[model samples]
Target chain A: QIAVANAQELLQRMTDKCFRKCIGKPGGSLDNSEQKCIAMCMDRYMDAWNTVSRAYNSRLQRERANM
Target chain B: MDPSASGMGSVDPRLRHFIEVETQKQRFQQLVHQMTELCWEKCVDKPGPKLDSRAEACLVNCVERFIDTSRFIVKRLEQTQKSKAGFSESLSD
Candidate 1:
C-alpha cells in the first residue's frame, strides 16, 4: 500500500513535469511531436529521479559513517 | 489507567521499528521527488534521446549542491540564534 501510494505520487509529479516541458503551447490536439517529447521527458525524469535517490542515499551513508 | 497498555507502548517493538523505518523511507522518496523536479529544471534543457553525460553530471552536482545549501542555511540559522541569545543574555546582565 505504501509502495503503491509512493508510485502514484511519482507518476503525478512526472506527468506534471512532462506536460510542462513538452507542451509549449497547447494546440488543438496532442501533436505527434509533443507526444514524442513527452515520452522522452518521462524517460529522462525517471533517470533524474534515480540519480537523485542514489546521490542522497550515498550522502546519508557517508554522513552516518562520519558520525 | 496504564499508559503503556493504552497507547503506543502496547505495540510490539519490532512493529514500531518497522513503522519508523517505513516513515523514513517515505521521507526519502518525498525528497527524491522534490529534488528531481528542481534539478530537472536546472540541468535538463530539453528531453533528449537519453540523459546525456553532461546532464547526468549536472544532476549529480545539483543534488550535492542542494544538500550543501540546506546544511549551510541550517548552520547559519543556528549561529544567528546563538548570537541572539547571547545578546539578550548580555542585555539582561
Candidate 2:
C-alpha cells in the first residue's frame, strides 16, 4: 500500500540522516562500538522527534482552546 | 498517492485531504528531527545510558521556545512593515 511505501521512505531517510550524524567514517564492518552508538543515536533521535511532536501538538491545542 | 489511486486515475477528495494532512504532519516531524539533531549537539553532552528527564525537558522546552521565537519574529516583522507602510503613506500625502 501507499502508506507502507511512505513509511519505508521515511524510515530510509531517517536512518540515512542518523547514520550520517552518528557515523563519521566507514570503519571495519560497522564495529560493535559503532553499532552501539548508532542504536543509541536512533533511539535518542526518535525521542527527540516525539518530544517535539508532543510539544507542538499541545501548543496547537492550547491555542485552539484559547481561541 | 496510492497505487490504487494511480490505477483509478483519480484520487478522492477525502483521500486527498487525508494525504494533505499527513504531508503537513510529516513536515512537522521532519523539522522536529532537524531541530532535535541541532539541539542535541548543543544541549546533549553525551549519549547517556538513557535520555534523562533533564535532557527530555530541555528538548521539550527547545521545541516550544523555537516555535515561540518563530512566531515572535513573524509578528514583529509584520508590525514593522505595517508601521513602515503607514509612515510612507502619511509622508506621501
At residue A42, give the lDDT of candidate 2: 72
Q: List TM-score per model, in order.
A: 0.86, 0.69
TM-score of chain B of each: 0.80, 0.67
Query: What does candidate 2's lDDT look like per residue over B1-93, in tens digits?
Result: 778658645777797888878877777666665676666665565665688898888987887788888889999977887867885566669
lDDT of 1 by residue, A12-45 (tens): 9999988888899899999999999999999999
Q: Interface Cα RMSD for all candidates?
A: 0.7, 2.8
Estimate, for each residue in B1-93, the C-alpha lDDT of model 1 and write its tens digit. Answer: 878557877799999889889989999888888998899999998888999999999999999999999999999977986867875466669
Error of 1 at B67 (Å): 0.8
Determine the backbone clash count of candidate 2.
0
Task: After superposing candidate 1 on the true structure, give the runs of residues whose Cα lies further than 4 Å from its correct spot.
Answer: B1-6, B85-93
Instruction: Give interface RMSD (Å), model 1.
Output: 0.7
How accurate locally is residue A67 in candidate 1, as Cα lDDT from 0 to 100?
98
Give residue A66's lDDT in candidate 2 (0 to 100): 95
Native interface contact recovery, all models: 0.86, 0.58
